[model samples]
Target: MQKRLANFDLDLALNVTESTLGILGGSGAGKSMLLRCLAGMESPSKGQIVLNGRVLFDAKSGINVPSRDRRIGFLVQNYALFPHMTVAKNIAFGLPKALSARQVRQRVEAQLAAVQLQGYGDRYPIQLSGGQQQRVALARALASEPELLLLDEPFSALDTHLRSQMEQEMVTRLRTFNGVSLFVTHNLEEAYRVCQDLLVLEQGHAVAYGAKYDIFERPGLLGVAQLTGCKNISAAAEIAAQTVLAGDWGLPLQVVDSIPDRLAYVGIRAHQIRFTEHANQCNTVPCWLVSTSETPHRMTVFLKFNTQPDHPQDYHVQAEVFKEKWEMLKQKPLPWFVQLDPLRLMLLEA
Candidate 1:
C-alpha cells in the first residue's frame, strides 16, 4: 500500500504486490497491523494497497475487500491447528467442497510429503512434535494456493537445532511455490542466511534497508550497529575537520572524512579493530590487560584504558579480536596497543 499507515506515527510510503513482502520488526513495530491491512481485517486511514495491478485497499476509491476474498496465505505464530482434525484434513480444510474427495486426498498427500512429513497426515496435533505441527501449519496455508505466503516466526516454536533444520526446509519448500514468502525471524544469523536483501526496522520506523552486506559492513546508526552486533560503539567529539573518538579502550580515532565539530557516535566491528604494538605514538592508544580467552578458532582478550590519549582524533575502541595475533596477547597482563583500522571504523552522523 502507498502510504498506508498515516496514524500512530506510521508513515510508510511502501510498495507491494503479490510478491512476498516481509513486514519484519520486533513486537509492536506495526508488522501485524500491516498484515491486517493487507488481509482487509483492518483498513488504513489513507493509502492504496495494490495487488497484481488491482487495488485492494484504495481510500480514494472507497474499496476495501473482505479478508477471505483477498486470497492470501497467512501462517501465524501459534500454528492454529484444529486439535481434533488430522494433519491431512487440516491441510485440505481451505479447499473447495466441489473438489472430488479423491482430489482433496491427493493434494493433502502431496502437501504432507512436500513438508517432509509424508505419513503424518493421520495424526492429530497433539501427536506431532512442535516442528512437525508447524510443518502441518505451513502445508495447510500453502494448500489454499494463495498468491503470497506470510509466515510470522514460522520457526519460533522449534528448538535451536530444529529451528536450523526447519530453516533449510522452509527454503526448499518455498522454492517450489511460485509466490513470494514473507518470513519473519529474529535470528540475525538466520536473517543473514535467508535474505539477499534486508529491511531493518526500529521503533516503528525503517531505520535501514539494503543488501545484507551493506547493512552489516556499513551500519546507518548506533542502533543498527548494536542490532547487528558490531561490538565497539561509543561517543566521540569532533574537533573541526578531524573527528575524535575516545572511549573505554583509551584509543582516539580521527575521522577520515570531514564532519562538523560536534559529538557523534563511533562504531567499529570487533574483527576490524586491530591490536598492533606498532608504536607508542598518537594513533596507537594503550590498553591494560584485564583478561584473555582463547578458543579453537580465535582469541578474545579483554582490555581497559585509563584516559583519552592524544590523536588526530578519529575513532573510539573496545572490542574482541580474532586471528593468531590475538594468541600472543593472552600470555601477558599489562599495557598493550589497539591500532584502529582506519578503513573499517564508522562514524555515525549526528
Candidate 2:
C-alpha cells in the first residue's frame, strides 16, 4: 500500500502469519499510517490487503471492508477509553451486537480475566491507574478475537516504571494471542524487547525488515544503524576482504566477517567499545579523553584520537563505560586506549 504524508511517502508490502512484527521508525516515518490502513481506518491509495485468507481491501476489485467488519484490534497510545463507560462496558463495545446480553457479559468477563482485571470490570477508566487503564485497552482490543492486532505506541504515554510494567504485561498477553500482531514504536529498546521480527521505516520507505537480531546487529543500511541506536558510525572504504578504513574516526577496522565491495560506512555500538591498556590490539586506537556524561548506571565518554586531533569532528568517538569502570578511568591520565571488538563491528552498505 502507498500513503503520502506531508513530507514523507510510505510504500510498504508486508506479509506475515501469527507472529509479532515491530514497525520501528522516527516521527513522520508512516508507522501509524501503515497500521491505520491495515485496521481499515484509512483506505490505501492502491493495492490490496489480505488477512487470514480474507480480503480486507482490494482497490482494484472495489472491495473495502468497514473497520468493524475487518475484525482487527487497534490499541492507541492514549488508551482511548470512554470516561463514561465501565471497564466491562468498554470491552463489551468491541463484541458483536448479535450476541445475547448473557454472552456479551461472559465474553467481557473472560477478556477482563485474560488481562488480569477480573473484579475491576465495573470500575470506570478514571478510577484505574495508568497501568490498569492500559490493561483495559488491551482487554478491549482482544475482546473481539481479531484476526490481526495492531498496537501504535501503546506504552508511549506511561511513566518509565509503568512502561516497563506494561511491556511485561503485553508480553504475557501476546504469549497466547493467536493472531497476527504488529507493534509500532520509535523506541528501539522497546521494539527489541517485544518483537521477534522488525520492520524499519524511514521517510515512508521500508529500509530493513528481518529477524530482530539480524536487523539490530547487522543493519546493512546506514539509516537502520542510526535508528537502531548505533552511536558510533563513520564513512568508510573497503581496504580488503575483512578490513575497512573508518574515515571519520581515523581508524582502520578489521572485522571478522567479510567486507563487501562499495562499503560506505562502519558502525559500532558505544557499549561494544572496550577499554584497553595495550594500544596494539587488532582494532585498537589510542584516544584522548574529550568529555563525559553520566547516566544512572553508565558513563558516556567522548574521545578523540591522539593521532588526529585536528580532525576532531570526524575523529570523535563515543564509548560507553559502566559507572565503576568510569570511576577507575577518572583516576588515570588524559590518554587511554579503546578497542572496537571485531565481532561487534558492523560494515554497512549505506
| lDDT by residue for model 1 (156-267), tens | 7789798888889887777677766665666667777776656666555677776778888777577777777677777766644564745544456666645434446777
TM-score for every candidate vs. truth? 0.81, 0.95
- Give me candidate 2's TM-score against the actual structure: 0.95
TM-score of 1: 0.81
Q: Lowest summed-lDDT stretch of 10 residues in model 1?
A: 308-317
CA RMSD of all predictions: 4.8, 1.9
Best candidate according to lDDT? 2
Best by TM-score: 2
